[model samples]
Target: MAGKRVAGGGGREEDGSKVGLPAMDLALAFPQATPASIFPHSVSDYYQFDDLLTTEERSIRKKVRSIMEKEIAPIMAEYWEKAEFPFNAIPKLASLGVAGGTIKGYGCPGLSITASAITMAEIARVDASCSTFILVHSSLAMVTIALCGSEAQKQNCLPSLSQLCTVGCWALTEPNYGSDASSLRTTATKVPGGWHIDGQKRWIGNSTFADVLVVLARNADTKQLNGFIVRKGAPGLKATKIENKIGLRMVQNGDIVFNKVFVPEEDRLPGVNSFQDISKVLAISRIMVAWQPIGISMGVFDMCHRYLKERKQFGVPLAAFQLNQEKLVRMLGNIQSMLLVGWRLCKLYESGKMTPGHASLGKAWTSRTAREVVSLGRELLGGNGILADFLVAKAFCDLEPIYSYEGTYDINSLVTGREITGVASFKPAALARARL
Candidate 1:
């Protein structure tokens, strides 16, 4: 009985237990608005920020928003429930000509970082999993090849990737090396004509269906980390889908195992000689992660906004109550603050001065804010918030991984802290003691 209260409806306790009342009679009680038109406006209607973009950027934002609302928002819940990627949406998404955004040449859209961040935010406003897929493909995979690959490699891969014919995955996190990726154990040994890879990568997104995978491994002979291009179905390479996840269930993360997987020498990223090169890629990817929490906050705010206006308590609408208004305002303020910082990071990235420390600060701040916003949203929804049917429950569950991935909060904070003070804080206490 405690969990049976219908959303947006008042209930009374009976026989020492809670009992929900019948649905409110809207036809006679409130003649102005109908349930059919209650949600006619998009969630973006609640926020007002027209001066943040130029005409072109605003147009791009509107186009992406329309596509996401019409295509992605409708079926997201079903796909998420089944834990299946919406492969059919690929063509439609590609038709927007935004797959390889932010990069010049190879038929890419060559948009600005602001436009790219807006696209990510709009897509994520509908579903974070879909946004993440795009982020990994464009920011991690294509950008890596563009920045660090040979000219021939770029010419070969960038075209198809721009067209979305080649979905890509980046494999760096191993079964044991998540936050400690610089110390990965995956190894690549040179052979007669190529190289053989042997190791395991866990939590690799899109690997189960990607056309190409960018894998990072240590060279056995030189003992230096390197990046490689590994095509799907390579010999001795296996990717098994990780299932029954509590969050981002539709994204298709995999556990990849490589046993002497053969890759031609040409496939190795020539410019990637050490973990330092890989860090360049991660620095950009972390900025994209900063936008993830923005999306999560948007989702939570939309749900909570709808419920507060409809739900009634003590003969008054919930929105009219001071405490409820305070909670909703606080959530909005937090979102705006997070967005401001994320936008500044994008600007810094565009100016060509963005550092890992800057990206780390944004990622850590926004993710922690998003967690709090979603938790407050769940509290506002009361019992129904825990049910998946309401969507807030899913937002609550999904925020956990976003906070941990792309570098956990503690790691990011230490990164920024060390940069500001010129102190190395990443060493373990025992190691620091030994050094002293």
Candidate 2:
């Protein structure tokens, strides 16, 4: 017996089994608004945040925003889906002149901290993975060289790095020590001409293909922390790509191993004798990390704003619904408050008053707040909220890693708590009480 044709042309056979039809293209099925391919306009600046920026900062922001929209935006979903870095976009990213941020000379831009922080936000506003790539490269690796490297090391390394001609990765976190990175067991032992580094590092962004690795290790003799400039492909040094990441897919994070890798004396960072020296670098990088959520929240809000106005149900735009309007307003409010906190953090750093507590609080609070904003965005998008092409879902996932990195929200809160109350709660007190 022949199959009976279904209502939409799919058929049911005599056995009562249905024959499948080709899946309809999403665009054909939902011919309403477009995906993030043609990025949205900046409507999230509800409080005229531009008024807070200096002329130069505004120019940098504009340049970064334009280039990111034109170049990075179109390719993000594709590369993100593949879980691979878009190596082709390197030149486009480098052209923004935001690399080597706040570092003077050595062919760097030397923009103010505010300008650097703003640039971070702009890049992240489009793609958090791109922002993380640059953060690990410029903010962590290049800044380490600039602040702690010998003059020769800086002269040799910073120029190409600043141009993105060569990429860099900072390796500090280990498989066993992420939040407790200060206790990393990677060791640098004295050798005839240099040091032999041995141990493993994990969750290092850009490590797989990075030309320079700013590796931190313990001094075998003194147990003090030491930093090394390990070149790519050093004998016994191996970086394997980590897979199945739920967020920041475009970043090539890796599990790196040092099997007696040698770092010449010239490559050792003399200024990083103790973990305290690394904190100096972290103090600056954390401020930039704090800006990432600010940018991510902005992007999510803009995406939701456009989506609500464009996508419709019940013969009216989704924006017309009272519930949706409230969510949008809540998202916008979060962005506004996030912008102020991030901006204030920058000002504190500029005045040399920014402490670990200040940077931690900013990163912790903005990221936590942005979580709410992106969640609202995901809700507003409804079914499309789960799709990466829509931007909100991608932003939603990207915000998770940012919330945990630089310092987890809870750890950062404790850091601030310790500062204000003059008591540290990072370690458990139950052990000491039991001993007593």
Candidate 3:
């Protein structure tokens, strides 16, 4: 048989041939079997974990999957090509009742954390930008309201948000503050009738066309970070669409400028007063970020699996090579381990036992693993990997933000290390002062 010799590990003799041979026929052949289907057309087999869901949860997952495959997938590549958001899908997505999957009341579904994870995984498998849009809307925007908004705020915001009648963006990252979100320089000063917000926010997702924005600013008087609901078109609120992103081109990222934007007292999140309140929201959102990479890894895995089986070299399928098989198995193992971690983290969140360190660990581990998986997938595709038609190239680009956002791998590692060691290691040793 003609095939390229793939060298790896110890050699095993077959049919009187030594290991590492170009090809060998096994003496003990069971039978020649037909090739199994590569991947399910419906993606049901891809998400067999649905059996773990409750009846209601399962129904919602199926419905969301249907919407994604039918509505989102067909148009995703086009939008990705043009680097634009599909605002048209909002109405259909809203009709699915998934925007507030795990939140209670005000027209939210109040489902379990598992359901939320499943929804994110399904949407992301088809289109990551679409998944990000929901993740920001449901987890960041709606979860902030659930965790830190007043009853009146929830009642007013949650309904429109659940129905997708209104879109929301969370603005915490400033023009200068990416990793040091707490040190944000945006200022809010109290006026007679309301507060004046002045500052610029960068890399704000969904803000380019969002109906409302949850803005975080430091109070000029108290010097405490505060959250406010700044409606779209508010005076002095300017959102400029950010262009030319190498990844996530389908999602609209924006740079927002709040120049003396006046917001009423009622618009301020009453429960938010200090950075601690903001920490609460970040804690939950970080865990949500963890799942994005898991989904991306799975997408890469599926693509690689299919390509390996279909693409041939030396007149033999690429999957026939032992080295290729080893790569596939390694990728699968990493994906499975990451999925288990994500599942357990979601459980901890549902039980109210989750901490900032837990979110940090999940985000750090999965995001790093996702970057590795995508890199490997790109390598497996050879020269074709760099081409946009292969899709792995896009996955490669998208994983960069996943590894950096929420918190970089280094920052999250230090956070988890501090929790385990019971010591703070945020700054350099030269800056550390000994406790008296």
On lDDT, the candidate that comes out on top is 2
Candidate 1 — which residues are off by over 4 angstroms?
1-48, 313-315
For model 1, how does the per-residue alpha-carbon lDDT over 4-64 read when each residue is reduced to its tens digit? 5444433544334545456465555544322221222345333455477789888888898
**What does candidate 3's lDDT look like per residue over 169-281, in tens digits?**
88999878888889999999999888999999999899989887998999999999888999999999999989988888877889999999999999989888999987877
> Which prediction has more favorable lDDT, 1 or 2?
2
Give candidate 2's TM-score. Answer: 0.94
lDDT of 2 by residue, 1-436 (tens): 3445454554655556767776586688777877887789999889999999999999999999999999999989989999999999999999999889999999999999999999999999999999999999999999999999999999999999999999999999999999878999999999999999999999999999999999999999999999999999999999999999999999999999999999999999999999999998999899999999999999988888888899989999999999999999999999999999999999999999999999999999999999999999999989999999889899999999999998999999999999999998887899767778
Report lDDT (Cα) of residue 436, candidate 1.
92
Predictions: Cα RMSD each: 6.7, 4.4, 11.5
How much does candidate 3 score in TM-score? 0.86
- Which lDDT values do the candidates have, in the order given? 0.82, 0.94, 0.80
Sorted on lDDT, highest at the top, how do the candidates line up? 2, 1, 3
TM-score of 1: 0.88
- Single out the weakest 10-residue window by summed lDDT for candidate 2: 1-10
Give TM per candidate.
Answer: 0.88, 0.94, 0.86
* Clashing residue pairs in candidate 3 (N, C-alpha, C atoms within 3 angstroms): none
